[model samples]
Target chain A: MKYKVTESENISTVFLDGEIDMDVADNVREVVFPLIDSGKEVHLNLKGVQYMDSSGISVIVESNQRAKEKNTKVELKEVSQPVEKVLAMARKFL
Target chain B: MNTEATNLSEKKDFLVRSSSLKDVRSFSREVFEKFKIDENLREELVLAIAEAAQNIVKHAYKDYPDTQDRMAVRISCTDKELEIAFFDKGKPVEESKVKHRAIDDVKPGGLGTFFIQEIMDSIKFKEGDKPWINNLVLTKKL
Candidate 1:
């Protein structure tokens, strides 16, 4: 998967594309954690994500957790149906 | 055990093993098509199977470090419902300790089982066996 980060004042928008699976789980952790740990508002755009798996869901959930630790807000936008299902399922646990 | 009967029993035992996560979807699609399962139901079933299979590759055998034993996933579907079981000789998951950590709280793991249970009708885990098996069964009305 490919991810691009754009910073706008207080919010950081991360654009993600391609499939998010076990192979790319670490990449997500490396990219999103530091930003959340820095206490900046984060928005994840999943419009371009073609596919997702459980690992992908874990990454997003973990990112949200890190953001909470720093009092930063995180939101998800333009999530695809498949990606949405995974996210919705994750929401149930929350 | 008679020689003839043992050979017959061996032949009757069927196993379909796959290591590819992508195949999880493909396998689900094939089973749905072969059984004339509903289209909407097919998508749901695929999602459940994909999540379960991906969990095997991600958590069960995650400690390998070197992807040597990439993990194996086996699926069997019948007219009533679909059965998918993941076999990994990795560290056994402690059921009592296993809790669906809140997504909002965000820890790095623990969502796989929750997702599987959410999408599928039922889920069961067994680690008493030496190989450590996580078997999940999903059912949809015909």
Candidate 2:
């Protein structure tokens, strides 16, 4: 996966591109976790991401939990259709 | 427009590694397209297939990431149902211990199995005959 980050005063928007699976979940955590740790609201731009598996969802879930602990938040933005479908299925469990 | 025959089947083997999960999805999409499966249902099937494949890579081969093992995914469709089977030679799967975490526990790690359960009609784990150790079969009605 490929990612680009944009930072404002207190929020970091990460534009993630490519398919996300177990192979790339750790890399995603590596990218998003520190931003949450810095007490910044993180916005993940999923416009370019067309596929995300459970592993990717785990990253989102973990990031959300961690953001809550850090007193910030992580929001998903411009979620693609495929990812939206997966998220809809995951929402059943969440 | 799906005039293709319903009695279709395809199988492919991938290296049992996390990186091969993409290849597993790609192969599944190709077979689904060839089989003329419903457009709306294709991605869900792909996700189910990829999740099962990921389980093999993550759980079965947990101790041997560098091993050159390969796992096979076979997708077969009959007139009444679609069946996807996974054959792996990794550590034997303990059927009793394969349940997903309770929904009340809300966690990141167990969603794969949960998603599989949600998408597929039935999931069965069987002991493979030879050369393979675990046989996972997931089916959905067409």
What lDDT does each candidate get? 0.64, 0.90
Docking class of 1: acceptable
DockQ per candidate, 2 decimals: 0.33, 0.66
Per-residue lDDT value at A91 in model 1: 63
Runs of candidate 1 exceeding 4 Å displacement: A37-39, B1-20, B30-36, B91-99, B102-105, B125-142
Judging by DockQ against the true structure, name the best candidate. Answer: 2
| DockQ of predicted model 2 | 0.66
lDDT of 1 by residue, B1-142 (tens): 1122111100011122223655556666775565556666666677677666655555565665455553444555444555555556656666675556654554444576676677777677765345545543444334
lDDT of 2 by residue, A18-94 (tens): 99888998899999999999999999999999899888888898898999999999999999999999999989887
Q: Looking at model 2 chain A, which ten-residue stretch has the lowest summed lDDT?
A: A53-62
C-alpha TM-scores of all predictions: 0.70, 0.95
Q: List the residue pairs that clash in candidate 2.
A: none
Error of 1 at B44 (Å): 3.3
Q: CA shift at B125, candidate 2, in angstroms?
A: 0.9
